[model samples]
Target: MTSTDTSDTSVLDDPVGESLRGRHAPLGRTLGRAAAYAQDVATFSAVPADPTAADWSDLARLLGPGAFADMFSCPALPPAGWEPVFVLEGRQMVWPDGGRPDPEPAATGPDVTELGKADVPEMLDLVALTRPGPFRPRTRELGTYLGVREGGRLVAMAGERLRPAGWTEISAVCVVPELRGRGHAGRLIGALVTRVLARGERPFLHVAEANTKAIALYERLGFASRKEVTFRGYTTP
Candidate 1:
């Protein structure tokens, strides 16, 4: 159900934390001010926007010593012993409120299919080939996923991730390299946007700032950049 007002955008600031505390609570763990998804689901972890030392300690304990923490877009810095892993520049884009576009006709219908547990193998293979983002073995458990197939092989896909209250993040949008330039990514995203809007939640997503092509496609589909984000990962000590 809807956990927050659809127009309230504050929850977008701490999406991972909001998701863990709201819709994704069943798939997450928390200790003090720290929370993380199940090991196989996602590597994301969250703490207060202005985290204290104890918050860092709690997160480290929750993840166990030396575990990797994918702190998606949280600008707070961790304690010294928390070694930096990787950092990437990205931006959060959201569907304009009340702007609903028709789902791409070809993307729906028989060509696009709802993906489930049995499709994980193929999904992983697609992710490996496309390098969309941090997709894990149990990532599909987060929300609905859809894929397009041709020649009886999966060629493209997109799906939801990080449900923060009334917002659903459309993520893992990828296509086989050979199939690039086709409208598969846009069509899959358009279909997902319709699905998210149909459920009364708004659709949002993050894209690496360097990926200009993807950004252009998303903008063309009516998404607007809400904020710039620096995605960071760290090793807990």
Candidate 2:
């Protein structure tokens, strides 16, 4: 299952009605005239009163020359002629029912290791093998990441991403093909949820709407779908 997330409580039909237009948008990273990642951990999810020439220009400027971004927006994004690559309708799911910590599951495989910068090579290898999601070299700098290893090789892992005011997203969850059915992903998610709850925040995630298997697993783990989102990656011209 691929773990990830993008965007707000619910986007507004009127972008200027008080959400995206304000200096203090719900998203900490979004700034004046646009809300986007300065670090480019993920795409710039924005809400312009309308996708005007200037609005798109602001998005492009924030992204920089020829840089790409995966923009998550609501139903009506006017065609801005940005280069398109990957696009999908996704679900923003939140753990409204809270964490279900399994005491034994935390140590399911070999002891879970708190991964750090030194472990990025193995982490990137695992991510490449599993296709979890976009994990840049600096992505690890954001927050806590934990993994399970067997015989000195990373087998499974999970981590955090896209934090809004009161919610932290659990992302990059995957287990190597040879290590499936060992409950590794579940254990990692449980651990992440516990940490988020400890910090007085809720856990949330995003996944493709068609990813029924992962969605079912999350539903069983107390996550409820909050909104349908269109996650789009564009190569800025």
Candidate 3:
């Protein structure tokens, strides 16, 4: 298993290569090449440095003709044949001790509930309203998602994203604009963390570097920043 944080090599030297290679290997679209990613290109894209032209070819063939992203753990110059759709920078945080954190003495609001496949429509609508991240129809298959509903409307949610080997990513954590400070996000995160720990896995997540509010929240909740990663978007010629 690759460490959540690495300093043994330059990020450009390995980038997200190890984690992609080790944890999400089964979800990979290509083999025998340094680049790998989840089966869902719409969800995420990543490339290790120094991918051969053939590696790109295999990924392109899997992706077919369209626009998608290629998120590198470290920022580097774009490859020759691909068009740069956009570039993003963010921080990856992790809770290494299997998501265990000091228990909060406060009570979880009654509106909070565990969500399943039956909740996809409401989940997508909330995702559309909040734009937390790329949440597709099947993204929920990654793991459990918890939410807080108000008047039968899903208002806040937090759920798993990437599942490498021993860790599960807590992602798409969002709350409606009107419900910002009532601890809805915290409630959902706590619920998810509990679930991750119960299953013998740790929790991790990503957030834009500029999103200090969320960063502070995660920090307060005992998550530590692991690395600064660049999310690169790519498109075919």
Candidate 4:
């Protein structure tokens, strides 16, 4: 097996590469390489491969349906009521070169800032403003969350999730409907990406296949989709 120099922290210093590192690190070296290679092959079809269906099935059984449905569908196949059981997607790992220009810092609003643990109640309320699925009040414990507050009411927020060793997945990004189109989302992403870089980790994220607008935004932020993987599962009764 090829060895990765885990001690090499260069990738974690650049904003782009740092984000990828956070997402890739926690999976550990071996599993991270395996997952990346599998995604590459599955997407390009240059190599013939059949990943074990059981693996997906097991994850589906574990994560349940509501969460799974956001990513994929089982296509009316098997077990009569089989739902999407897993979510999978691919990202092109980006490394910053000297020639790459740094993104201009986002303009901040008076109310936008890093969130504190004391803000948990309001944070849940802000998350409710967006209606992301299966979010529990306690989900705040998952990772660092940042938010924008208006007169002390949490209005917009985004944060990290699904942390692997060197990589962290950016999830739970949203702003109130009334606040949309004001570049709040971009600012939140920029700030969160900055935090991820400071931690010596890389950042990555997943989006629904059909969300063209979100995909476009990520691309503008220097993320490129490298492969596609289906997330399959069903809702629990």
Candidate 5:
């Protein structure tokens, strides 16, 4: 589902609007214009069976030149006249099997607990330590973030990103290098997904195209790739 312009004034007249409203009805009629544009915004999902030069041009216009490479999914080789500075391939993993999985049934440890705003500073540190992306100080404010603390230190964390219509993206998933393979990432995701389902919305996530290990983990968790997409960030020249 794609839309070209924002001229569709009425909420009923816009597909993006309809999709967003249908998915996030609980959010009520308070949809912000930024949210609406964000709903319509797509990078790799816009790839047509036979994309044209105009399509690339329009995509460039929508994303601008300063876009991040991880923000978009494009063909291995872009069409002529379209030169992508960088491309990141990722999959939009959807939970075909509804309902959150049982919450691990037991806690990993007393130190492994969910975090709140008070943990933001430590969460940001974990993100930096893991180097997930260009995380800002306020990024944690984007959604409900959960973490596991070991000895009162934040060691692993995961949280939400990109809210397109009914879909809630689970991103910024990272665990301290020392805590790798400890299932902390999974636990955080599981708990967070539980919250998303409780709100009656679906959960989805993205991973770098080259990340086969993470993909396998997600698949094991009942998430399947719906389609390949890209996250591209741009900057004005």
Candidate 6:
């Protein structure tokens, strides 16, 4: 991976917050310093960097009683009444400077197609089988999604999420278990990377630390680790 100045990484420190407040503002609900995506859009919620008591209260009110809040990579812990739901160790990886993917096969293959609302059912089915991450019915509304099909059945897919300032997150890159190691993921990600860079934004993604195979693929695709992160979720109190 090629080295580049990372002085502007502060925006990434609160990606969920930045996104909810910026490009995704219309798709989210904000209450004071607390904010979250609309129901069915995504489960991610956010608070100020140094959250106050009121911030937690606002988030709780926003999510209502006993709602699940996916605090993606937020460093602050919530109040005692908020129950921990899940936590995953992950890393933020960014496309390195001067890095570019070879032309994506999607450029020529009829199998690679842009997905839409009509594809959500199959997309959800794939997510259920792959456990890529949190993907709800409306999640695709967040950004562009692309999928690879085989004999008219969706098999592999990837898409954009969390547009934080000048960056776009490449997420939900998953392939069928039966089709593993076939370079489908790499192609999907490469296509998305090309699209992101073309629009004057950088590409980044999060991957579970235990998924070493994915980390290797990301590295091979010109992504370099920026920082370790803890993905946390909690129940609103």
Best candidate according to lDDT: 1
lDDT of 3 by residue, 1-237 (tens): 444432222232343454556655555555456354554423455544565666666666656667465554545454577788777788888775534666355536756677898999999999999999888877776667888888888899999766655667798999999988888888788878887777666777889988999999999888898878777678854
* Tens digits of per-residue lDDT for model 4, 88-111: 443323323211224535555645
User: Candidate 1 lDDT, tens digit per residue, 87-175?
Assistant: 99999999998899764444434367899999999999999999998899999999999999988899999999999888999999999
Q: Name the 10 consecutive residues with the lowest summed lDDT in model 6.
A: 1-10
Residue-wise lDDT of candidate 6 within 97-151, one digit each (tens)? 5466775343344366899998999999999999999999999998999999988
Each candidate: RMSD: 1.6, 5.9, 4.0, 9.0, 8.1, 3.4
lDDT-best of 3 and 6 = 6
Candidate 3 wrong stretches, greater than 4 Å: 1-42, 48-50, 72-78, 96-99, 103-107
Give per-residue lDDT, candidate 2, residue 152: 91
Q: Which has the higher TM-score value, candidate number 1 or candidate number 4?
A: 1
Model with the higher TM-score, candidate 3 or 5: 3
Please give the range of 10 consecutive residues that has the lowest summed lDDT in model 3.
Answer: 6-15
What local lDDT does model 4 show for residue 158? 84
Model 4 TM-score on a 0 to 1 scale: 0.60
Model 6 vs. true fold: TM: 0.94
Q: What overall lDDT, based on C-alpha atoms, would model 5 receive against the true structure?
A: 0.56
Q: Can you list the residue pairs that collide in candidate 3?
A: 45-71
What is the lDDT ranking, best to worst? 1, 6, 3, 2, 5, 4
User: What TM-score should be assigned to candidate 3?
Assistant: 0.81
What global local distance difference test value does model 2 have?
A: 0.68
Better of 3 and 6 by TM-score: 6
Report the C-alpha displacement of residue 30, candidate 4, in angstroms. Answer: 20
